[model samples]
Target: MDKELKQLDNTFRKLPQYPTKVIQFGEGNFLRAFIDWQIQQMNKQGLFQGGVAVVQPIDRGMTKVLDEQDDLYTTLLEGKLNGQKVQDHEIIESINETIRPYEDYQSYLDLAKNDDIQFIFSNTTEAGIAFDENDNLTDQPQNSYPGKLTALLYERFKLGKKGFQIIPCELINHNGNTLKEIVLKYAQLWDLGQDFVDWINQENDFYATLVDRIVPGYPKERAADLEKEWNYHDRLIVKAEPFLIFVIEGDKKLEKLLPLKEAGLNVVVTDDMQPYRNRKVSLLNGPHTTMSPIARLAGIDTVGQVMKDPDFYKFINDEMYQEIIPTVALPEQELNDYAEGVKERFENPYVNHELSSIALNSISKFQARLLPTFKRYFAKEKKLPLRITLALASYLKIYAGKADFAPEDTPEVLAEFKELRQKDNYVQATLADEKLWGEDLTQFPGLIDLVKQDLQIIDQQGSRKAVQMINEKED
Candidate 1:
């Protein structure tokens, strides 16, 4: 049977009444299930009359599926919340329409001139913001999402329209602010004039947001059960955890703009989202970055498996609680609670987060996620952290692209590592790369020798032995 063409379940077919006031820049599952789902709730409660006009950020996305279903899709929220097993299902109907920017560039540009549009939401990922100097104002849809946004903002300014409140849900820190900065840089590069720049600076409300959700998106693995349960096949069915948090650093007026709190959501409007950001980065991202290479090399495939491994779990707790948490500036009890929550998130049995997937751009990740702890600890104790330094060494070795002691995984650190590996000076080549390490790692007392020694250990005895060696090493 062609189940996707069948009618949706009775509970999900009914559409909610709301006005289209938001132009979302990404139509992926995360935005659909998380953002749109919340909007659906708001519409149902009569707290919000706004709907989302989803814009396909890139050339390719779920626009076809969305268009096929009249911008309607089902989301399955399943997980433990507050010591209770919760499973809920709903079809999101807050998406008024979906547009492909490449095909209907004029239509997308025309959206900016709409006085009804007041909020812009996006989750274009970490690399979405960049200074693409070649992106002229006339391009159909600029190569980067931020570039397209710059053009849109300029159009809005030209029309003498009020600035829209922007809330970017990218995983990067200061995401909205960074995106605004890049857009301004593009405006300057194109010489869009001071008026437009001033409009962006003074009028536009760029609120940095911290979003938390374990949206796995599309349950391809559990298709049979899902199809049976829903009584229809949905290619775009998104699965997510029950927990969701959206912290926006903006004016309290946003409470009136987005009444998500009234609709029973964990949305927070604050003057600063720094504490929440720090908690997420230090507790969640920090452990993930440190554990990925170590776990992957330990023969564990998923984060669930790594959490199950006693050694890896202990390493995370010891490094995060005993070592990393102490260095962070937040209160001790709050940091401990965050660390506990992070451990639970890592141990999420439903998600099969691949360690190898997390290993991409690991060098840069270490600097962003883990280096703060490294710096803080060194300054406080005047000694290097052994486990973290070992993790760094493991990362460098993993980038050597080896699986069974010989080169196997594709190296994605940079071209220099590959070039240096060819010259039989892997350690020297890596340590000397000022761009990779920021400064020479050799300058950090015995860091180079320690890293080199750990690399050799990993090469000889494998990841498990290397971790054991570090665990046993006296500080």
Candidate 2:
């Protein structure tokens, strides 16, 4: 057991208390920097009088460390806002306590019975909301996130408690709907009956949400320096960018309850969040996915580094504005505005976002984020999206291993790339593989020939010089 640190209220004069009104699953960096921080902002304004009880979603988490700090931690926000550096640090006081449900089942159930807890928030990673057939309701805590939530809801139902507005911030599409579906599946599987299902439907509000923030979690490299600067030692310190937006697709009335926008937070409650999702995934995530490989191959280690290089910056800018922005279905001005913000975020000095980290699971990320833009740009303009073609070719080299950063993909993908190292016309074979891609990718107009051309340029000029070609070429 670790010795608990003395309460921080003395160091930072703070609120005495707030009634626990939120039950947040997953005490990870993203939730702490985004959701809990937002709650603290609201509490600061006296717009909200509620606190959060964090449930450790996974067994091995930072709940113990959180407890040591008396559920208090500092969130450091740093990035460019309106062309100037913005930095702020706040000791978040929204968290009332931390609970590990796996350790105590009855205590978890008792938390569910709290009438003041009106909102349920989670960011249990993409794979958290799954159905584990092995999960039994009688188990102390079920195997999957949905199963655990089902038990919590069931406990509340039995006590005649009001349902929570469940908002899931998983990166997966339709997060809340997926979680709600799995909960229903659990209800049927456990023979919890139609009453439970009906209660979940009628009483609970399941929201599909889109969350955007650049939270790089703990500052491992700079932690000592930060602690020295702040005159405090915090194991759970979270580093975040200045920009944040949470878009929830539900009735507008729900906004009144959270009162986030009123707190000067960037929160939107719209009837349809699909457009917002598309905007974020395309303008922000798409660039990261496509640029990481190319930039890393060009000997740039971080997104910020790429932004500093004029040649490479122009290359990426041309691709985003000329190729991607032209194809998005949203308004041109909106896309431009978001793209500007993305550039600022990439140039954030405090956050050294490694290209290697962004390069994780590259195959799936490319398909979801960049493929649609590639397809639309080609189909709409009747010309090959040249930058995208180059990015596609650079991807092969990225997966080949031996870059400064290690490559991590499925075993099968790594093995195939190893085999492709020996095979002739490997690009054709790679794009033709229906299994690797969802379909035969070579059929797209000018895709095969143009990608081959880019591969040759990459080989001759090298990645750094090849990127310089984008600035000179009219195309």
Candidate 3:
């Protein structure tokens, strides 16, 4: 067996450190596998001469372990690349060092002073950008991500330095705009004066970015076998799918700052990322959420298997092409191309995306990913979309214990399900639960009856048989 690997030990050649040109906020698997890996590729091509300094946004994080390994880690890229199974692995040497902001606040602010630092990237989770009024400006490192950012921006504004191009890759919609609003709120709450606000508004450019990549991260189950093959005992060996798409809503001139397009990366630096965002959320995410419960009930496990199965495949495509695409606002050809790409991504040979994993908090996921499309499809067609409604029925069935599918929801949600199961008018009652769907879904005419009918069919037949019936009815 190979020895445990650390940085710059004679086992591997030492890499020359470039100037820290990007200050990143999250050192987690997603950023490391996606963003840092992209930077490593650009640096290898000699197109980008920079390094990333990852800061641990929260106190309890992986910075200590990262620092122990000298910030070096391996990324295993495995998935179908252009219809061929490919597995590529490389040691990512892009991170210069990691910093814990809570311990060394001044050092964190000092990053803003670096002349070469032109970009700031972050993926601090969806809830990370929230405004925390309890966080004061004087508190070391501040409490929230935006609070720390506002403090750092005020420091840089005081020094009269050039502003950094900020792009937050948080999963929320319009993440950069939301973060900017919170930072402005913090500036006002902290009484940092109007000049700092102006500097923040005029100097820095915060771009809303949508990042897509499936980083399963740190294959614990296969680590020993993988370590034996690679002849290295790297702890941070992350696993990611081959598919990646980054859509950034930014000033076109700023593309020069992040010139990874030459490296053949699928980076769309567009002014309107909403359409791209819609395409991904609707076409990619919508189908995934809609298919999870139904697929699980059908005894299917992975997404690739769902695509390969004839009946499940037809059910997914019918939902996409008939209902989902009509709700999206994009060019016909463009949307069609994007849908095809999403299908390819779903069929990635190497990735085994479990339906149960996707089924976590599925009620909430349906509201965010599929509900808008469901409403829009009804509005345009003036009729309920059958497959989406059936998917809803499948979701309810899974939660109600009618199907053998296990669900992961809040106790409150499970309680509601239990109450609904006990009710005589369970279908109508559950459909009218405003707390679950934000608004009563029953307000849409024909929705209640259609869902009730689908539920009856699903109850009588199996999910796979119901899928066949859906396809036949669609045909």
Best by lDDT: 3
Clashes of 1: 1
The ten-residue window of minimal lDDT in model 2 covers: 1-10
Cα misplacement distance, residue 471 of candidate 3 (Å): 4.4
RMSD of each: 3.4, 4.3, 4.4
lDDT of 1: 0.79
Model 2 scores a C-alpha lDDT of: 0.83
Segments in model 1 whose C-alpha atoms lie over 4 Å from true places:
1-12, 356-364, 403-443
Worst 10 residues of 3 by lDDT: 5-14
Tens digit of per-residue lDDT, candidate 1, span 192-305? 999999999899899998888867677777866777776775667888788889999988998988899988999999988988887787778788878888877777877778
Ranked candidates (lDDT, high to low): 3, 2, 1
Off by over 4 Å in 3: 1-14, 58-61, 82-85, 101-110, 125-129, 132-144, 158-160, 296-300, 331-334, 356-368, 389-442, 446-472
Candidate lDDT values, in order: 0.79, 0.83, 0.84
Per-candidate TM-scores read 0.88, 0.82, 0.80
Residues 1-475, candidate 3: write the lDDT tens digits. Answer: 3456323322453456788999999998889999999999888888887999898998888888877667888898897767778799888889987888889988998887788998989987654766778899889978888998888888888888988899999866788898999999998998989988888899899999888887767777787788777776777888889878899998987668788887889899988899778888899889998899888887998788999998999899888899998889899789899889888888876666777767767877788788889889888998888788888989988888877756787555788898888999888898899867879988999888887777777778777887888798843
